[model samples]
Target: MSSTATTTEAAPTVELSTLPLRGGEKKAEEKAEEYKYAHLLPHFSEDRYPPLEPYKHIDPGHRALKHANPRAFLDSAERVVELTPHLGTDVKGINLANLDSDGRDQLALEVARRGLMVFRDQRDFIDRGPEFYKKWGQHFGRLHVHPTSGHPKGYPEIHLVYRDGNTSFNFEVDDSITTTVWHSDVSYELQPPGLTTFFLLASPPTGGDTLFTSQVSALKKLSPQFVAFLKTLKAIHSGVEQAEFSRAGRRGGIVRRDPVEHVHPVVRKHPVTGEEALYVNRQFTRRIVGLKREESEAILRLLYDHIDKSADNQARVKWEPNTIVLWDNRVTAHSANVDFRHLPDARHGARITPQAERPQPALEGLDLSA
Candidate 1:
């Protein structure tokens, strides 16, 4: 599991003539057979962020969590700790790429009330490269482009979290790493992200942590009559297992924008602290729309076992090697202990979500039958 020889380019080209593209962004030789091992995601031509043309994404919200400054954002925090009382905090002297725009609107309201923040000596904010990680996540909105993650070659908006994952297509001797699913990133996007960002390139020498929870504290430990029957139900977020794990090519073969589903609102309403969460996720939530498929798999397996057994609205982070986490893909639901990546020991990172709109409904027509 080792290789480092850069300078064998070719493969990625997108001349530009979009009238309707999206079959892997058209013409790498006309959908080049949906890329079968085309250097496992190698697309170039001095790409300045290529392969993104379809539009209609809209996140235009979170106006600095409504004019920032919660005491100059806790006086630019040089120590904040609150790793849980409903999700993480850990600040210690700000420098998230030198904020200030009212400290990035109070750091987006302290990541929408601590849905997870933590940031330690980010080696000078990742030595300021990768376009400052897509310019500090486009200052919070419209940066998401992960349809089977893998980036950092002309910055396809930097989203590549590989612990040998799809290492040029499944690098073997897979010992085991995957602490059972929990997600919120591509909520089967119709704009499904809200201020994410997890940069930690390479980490080990410890059990690789990362297991956040707190979907607004699992909707306040459920039962306001079962959260008004889960905000009048609706949940079917599917990118079809990222299009069958990138056409069964696993992780890196990317279909970019094909497998979509979007139904949302199994109680999700936090476009910047409108609160109310628990947006069903055992990875892309696939059920409970109008129930009855055995009641949507017994109410999505009892709300994914009440947000994976709340564990007092969990939080575990513990990463290093210039760490940095941001979290709050509209509430929280992460997972990846990678159990130290089967001791192959090399859990990489580079996420940069932003999208954030399209998923509201905290109770549109309330007055539940109680």
Candidate 2:
């Protein structure tokens, strides 16, 4: 990767009122105390994705296989998710500078914990999407490319957001906007994006909701034995899709073909938080690294059920005009609801900034070279 540094006259650092800590030496000490324990218990668990052997071929006559009791996946109802109100109806962005110090800390803390948060009516959502995300993103890594379907003009900085007007998925109603498949953004990259920010400008009149699932929560709910099994596995994520986009050479010949494709550790640690999370997703992940094709399919099926059925660990966001969502792509999976298929005026506005981070090994005991 290319590196560049630009020096700017430092702006006067404003002391916000909400956070108890301020930048410089004191803040570092306080942060250390706050997260000291996270380094102690590494979240290495095994068999992050399982096989499909236990399940049988469904009889063609049994149409009911399409939908089953949501509770059938679990003996207990621990993962039921309820939509909670976060951002209000206001169409104004909250300026972090104007917020109290504690408020700044609270927002920072929330993004760290939730892996994502929403904002309403961001005044600069469209114009400053890349710059705004760089604020927190620079601390992690560089922006990365989407393995597939990244907008041509944006290059590595951001992705263009558009919705097919007058379209909605039949299963749901909304402006033709919905994230259907569960996935982390562009895991095929050697250093995947750590964070992703989506700024919405114009949403269709009806449906456009994004779903986010927690990798940490998914692992925590699994059997400890199965968790242990997943630690040794890795899966391949291919760039056929991203490569296809590069073939088009859409932007100033800047979208070069990437050579990376194949598997990675099924579970990886968060470089910053030191927490282990399930790293495989329905998107890009093609197979288990060293396993036979049949074996890989079976195992992947098992792992998918464990992830897909865990609905309680997910949050869904409905977008409106001038909304922006920022999420940690490392420890979370997201789906854009593609349900706004039928609306004539369905559209969305967006500017996406990429992020970059190296993958951490699943086992803390293993050295980096291992």
Q: Top lDDT: which candidate number? A: 1
Best candidate, TM-score: 2
lDDT of 2 at 74: 21
Error of 1 at 87 (Å): 24
Reference-based TM-score of each model: 0.31, 0.63
Clashing pairs for model 1 are 12-43, 12-44, 27-30, 78-93
lDDT of 1 by residue, 1-370 (tens): 1111111122222222311124443343453344222222323222123343434443333455455345375575678888877788887776777775667666777777777888777667766767777877877777877655556555666765544321322222234443457777778776677878776555445665778888888888777997887788887787776667556654444465566686777887775567888788876788776557998898888888877777888887776556688877878887755554345433445677778677777988632221
The 10-residue segment with the lowest total lDDT in model 1: 1-10
lDDT score at residue 173, model 2, on the 0-100 scale: 23
